[model samples]
Target chain A: MSKFIGLIRNEHMKTFRRLSTWIMFGIAAALLITIAAFTAYYAEDSSGDWRADTEQQMQDLQKQVENGDVEAAAVQQDLTTMQYQLDQDIAPVQSDSLASYMESVMYYCAPFLILFIAIIAGGLVSTEFGTGTIKLLLTKTPSRFSVLTSKYVSMFITTVIFFIFFIGFSFIVGGIFFGFNGFDAKSVIFDNGETVTNNLLASTMRDYGLNFVQTLIYATIAFALSTIFRNTALAIGFSIFISMFFPTISFILSRYDWSKYILFNNVDLTVYNPGNVPAVDGMTLGFSIVVMAIYFVIITVITWFSFMKRDVTA
Target chain B: MQKQPAVEIKQVTKVIRGRKIIDRVNFSIYPGEVFGFLGPNGAGKTTTIRMIVGLMGITDGDILIKGNSIKTSHGAAMKHIGAIVENPEMYKYLSGYLNLVHFARMSDGVDKERINEVIELVGLKNRINDKVKTYSLGMRQRLGIAQALLHRPDVLILDEPTNGLDPAGIREMRHYIRNLAEKEGLAVIVSSHLLSEMELMCDRIGVLQQGKMLGVQQVHEMSSEQTQMVSFQVEPLEQAAIVLRDMGSKKPEIKDKQIIIELTRDEIPAAAAKLAKEAISIYGIQAETKTLEDTFLELTGGKEIV
Candidate 1:
């Protein structure tokens, strides 16, 4: 156990000392601060009373649908959504609260989170092979398993800290601009195909948890590729492409039956969360979790086994 | 007068794809000895070193360090060895001190004082805080040596340690390596293609060719005692030739005002004395002793080293 801890400390020191690592954090902070400033500055509260104005707008839309001047299907859908919001006591306004900003990080910035984590994970082991430091590392410990496990454990800790920083930084900057009220406001979600009300904090926390899982899964895939190929470019490039485009592909393939078993179809565990839709029809939260669990085991096993058996020739 | 060997390679063999890369090679390295591994290119020197450090698998035989087999008791055996398999590849983004600190934490019982001691021993105290990427090749090599010594292992194995060193740096390394072997009682194994450097740096030498062990011999036995061409630039060369023939020297050829004969170091003086008694005027007598280079060339049939 002490040896394992030593390995983790060593890995962390090596990782955090790099200038590139600090640059990544800098980019994340800059992007979030800019987003916060833009949203705070451009926010418009022209309605004066949002509930009364939105109710009037909803009546106008309903009148248009009734006159057969617009597509009834689309207008009917919008009316239904607005009615549900009114029922849940949700106002149509630019909410700049701490919880809302945190929610934006969970929703809008998830791709960036996956990108950063994937880059780090892809380069972690491959850089050792590229620079020939694996010789020094492997010689220090007897078991290769310990060396690799320490790296993964360090990555997990780094991911958690990065998540905390993102949320905490967003909260502080957003609160400074928009104040920290309305945290107990009601948010709308779909449960069992029915629109329902939920607390904002509970919904935002749930989304954060789901985003964490998504980031971890992508990072693991990148890590596995690092071991298999020993090239950072290929690993990182392929992971980014998958994270960005696989959902699109899955959407197109959803018409077919086999899309349900594809790995990308099951990665978005947030579909099980209240407000999101699953990639494929009839993909339950339980089914997606089982598929991802199987994939996780297979990826972890292959990575560890290959790393242990292959010679460190480089 | 048998002392226990610090490292023993007993019939170690490595095979890849049913083709032999390292045949059943065997040797032992003892404490207080500087053992040189000499070989031409593609001689499996690096492969053997990798096996010793537990980076590669052994196909047929086993290696034991301090009586612990590397195959069966790897962790215990590795605790007694410190090695740099090829070039000293370190984390370039880290400073030399941080690198050492990180590596020291991997092994058991290496403290800060020990890290400082090694840094001082390798003459890297001045630049220990600089990033490794900023270091010259020689400085990197020195840092590599310092890292290998941090654990105070019983054996130190370096492959081509002097590859990028300048002449002065090589001499400094040679001096430091000899001191470590003598004063600190660490068995040192160094592989290099530089024959003259090996001659000065090593007490005993082992040569490998085509993944096979040619033999291991003492430095003196390999070079100083071997027969060499002794040439005497003398006046009346034909008469001197006759004198050398009368002295029972074989095939003493007189060419270009010189009489040359193959003579061991002990026989050179006698050959000169016989010519003096014959009243042969000898202007200059030059005896050429075999160098490790010449011996290596003769052993491998004139294949290029390195």
Candidate 2:
């Protein structure tokens, strides 16, 4: 067990010591700062009467519901949340508030997180083969299984580190752009036709957690492709292609009842959150969990087996 | 009493994509000996080395390192083996010390002291902290040796250890490899297509051609055991040939105004005395020793060794 940890530590050293990793971190931070600056630049004044703004948003949502401009259930949920905010005298968090900026930019950051993780995971195994270091790596005391598992575990650890960096950096940047006064802000959530009040931090954490799951699935795809193909470029390219296009493909295929089984359709567990809709008409959080679990297992098994049984001819 | 073989390859065969890359190859290397795998390109030397190091699968038979079968107990088997297959390709982005540390952590009980010791042994202490990309090829090769020796394995396998090195670097590597086998009592396996390099570095060499083991021979004995072609530049070449034929020399031929005949080391003096007694004036006598290159060419049917 200690040896395995040593392997993981070795992998971490290799990953973090590279200039490319720090470049990725720099790009992620730049992206967050840019988004925060843009949000601040364009943010409208929200210091007016909160009750008037809630009524205005509710009226707009009602008009959209009547005109069928959006799904009635989703708009109805939004309407209920706004009404609950008004009834509880809880003002809607300003768009420029620290918590609101973080939440708004969190979804935008998810794709970048997936992209970064995909790039990292894609090169994790294939780079060894490309550089011909796999010979030295696998010839050690640890088994091939242990080596690959350590690499994967270290990839996850990197993802977690990147996540914390993203959250932490965004918080600091968001606080700079917008005052850090929304830490105790309340958020009104509509779940199953019922309104519930939750703190901003809790809801933001929940959203970040779900987004992390999505990033993990994408990372797994990239990692599996890396093992199977032994080409870092192709693995990263295919992963990026999938992340970029799978949603549209899933949407086109969603008309078919079997489309829910597609990984992309089930990967976005955020759809189970209130005021959002699943790609398919009937995918519960439980069902998506099972589907994602199956995919996760299958991809992980294929990756491990492929890596273990491969001949390191490179 | 015989020492146990540090590494044993028993009829190992590798079939890739319906083609036999390595066919029933067998050899063994005991401790304190340098075993050289001499073969041409595409002769399955790297493939066989990869199999021994668990980089490639063995289609048939097995490899045993320190009495542990690589197929059945790879972890245990690998613990006793250190190998650099084809090239000493380290992570160029990491410093040389970190690269050694990376490999050191993969094995059991290899500490910072051992890492520093190997760095000193390889003479890389001056630039051990430099990134690998900044090191010269010779420095990288030395670092490669350093990483392989970190665990102190019984068997050290290096495929083309002198590849891409200057002459001085090659000589240094040869000395290092020989010292490892002799002083440290490690069974060293060095693979190269250069016959002269093998002759200088290896105690014994196994010639592999077309994925088959032709023969394994002691490096010193291979040249001396064979008959040599002795040429006599005589006043009368035909007369010398006839005198040599009368003396029962086999296939004495007169060519280029010289008589050439095959003679063993023991027969050379007798033939010389006979020629002197026959009144044949010998202007010059040149005895060409049979080199390992000649034997290798003969064994592989003159296939290109480079």
Candidate 3:
């Protein structure tokens, strides 16, 4: 119906023109840049500021080995062995530049777009309550379900675009700053001598593609919080707390065999492989996605019904 | 002239958080009738009005719009009802005409020409195309009326149309509301704390006090007791009392302008002639008219509505 569409358009405009939306974009940009900076620094810093003393010690050991120092030669040999092991651990490592830097950064940074955007998403519903716009809406048309749906439709559409925009922005930066040869770049060293390698383009594109579904879940959570709380500040607070802390609590719980059933335990799907020494018994990426999808749907359903029935008198 | 009610609110009681917001309020407004809900601030007028439009749920009773129960189907109940609880929110960025058109799209049984017709009916055709942000309070009020009537509702309930307006604006709103009831045969229930404004505008008023209707009476019928007021303010208000104390007049007291006398209809002219001879210049000769305010205070036992 044109009425429903008009409601959506108006709701969309409510988010698109806000200071918080732009602030979200700013946070997203800054996060991408910061994550890229951190990755770039982490990769090249061994011979640079962070590990200057280690590089100096290696040079000194090599000199001693050349000057017929037996103890120093042994230490120099150990140093070479350590370096070889480190190289083997980080096998298939790509060159560090702004482009490759950003690729690595986005894997972590894209998830945070949910946090940056959750504030506006909360405000999308809560503002009507705080500002008393619901009275205006109900006075004209009294169907509370339609009104709530219109708001969700607006945020759903906008959040999708926001997710797409960030993915697109990071990819553009990746293609421009890092060489296109990174189409095959993969494999990276992690702590504990672990190596993660894959077809860079396919996995990265898959992650980017999955972001559409992921952001929708986040948006629905934001909506449920908004409708339940009726205050933008409170809604955003709850959403942020859940997003940031849920995964952490789940990670700590993963030490127990029972922890794998926790929804947040499956958050880190990128490097996790069931065939490898998996953390939990029989937990797969498909199962986790399905579970999280159910959680999202349940929250959305509760929001819609509650919003329709609750009194907007206050 | 009498007609069937377009809106009926029966035994409605609304309690929120252990506080009774509306208590057993009952009234029915017929088509072509301008019903004024007279009350002071916090008198539960808005709550009652919101219930009529189906924006709120009644705690104890029901509202019928064109005989349709609000509880059973509010969307259909709302179809016959148009209302402004306060100033209805208009999209500030859009033109007034566009705003009406948008509301029209949501409502059933409205056409594009109806939108234009309502624009003309509210007498805002000249500036309906202007963005509402630029509209004056009066212009916006008119646009609000236009939107309320977009679906051709049978009953139009306005909480406070003249709120925050200058004298001229109040008069303009009064004229428009009365016209809507008269010309379009829309049943109108306008609530206001300003008794004088309601007196000037409303045909029949229901005085509300403490969430209860004190009584409903016509503007003329309220003052029809026909009190005779005679007043005179002398140097010593009690001094002139001694001279007129021995008269056939009963308990004549010196007030501001004339000596007070509650005279029979036949005695008014004779008393006035005697007072004139005594040089008590009759600046005015009229009954102490019972305004809606006086009626409210009189009916509420001199206590404020809230």
Tell me the number of clashing residue pairs for each predicted model. 0, 0, 8
Residues B1-306, candidate 1: write the lDDT tens digits. 178999999999999889899999999999998999989888999899999988889999999999999888877888888888789998998999999998898888999999999998888999999999999999999999888888889999999889888998899989988998999999999999887888888888899999998878687563435677889998788888887885433689887778888777777788889889989888999966555667677787888877
- What TM-score does each of the candidates earn? 0.93, 0.89, 0.77
Candidate order by DockQ, highest to lowest? 2, 1, 3
Candidate 1 chain A lDDT trough over 10 residues, lowest sum: A91-100
**What local distance difference test score does each model get?**
0.85, 0.88, 0.71
Candidate 2 Cα misplacement greater than 4 A, ranges: A46-83, A189-196, B222-226, B230-263, B266-287
RMSD (CA, Å), each prediction = 2.6, 3.8, 6.7
Cα lDDT tens digits for candidate 3, A96-147: 6533554565567655767766766778777777756566677655377888
Candidate 3 or 1, higher DockQ: 1
Candidate achieving the largest lDDT: 2
TM-score order of candidates, top first: 1, 2, 3
TM-score (chain B only), all candidates = 0.88, 0.84, 0.84
Candidate 1 per-residue lDDT, tens place, A178-215, comes to 78776776666556656777777678777778889889
Which candidate's TM-score is highest?
1
The value of fnat for model 3 is 0.32
In candidate 3, how many clashes are counted? Answer: 8
- Each candidate's fnat, in order? 0.62, 0.92, 0.32
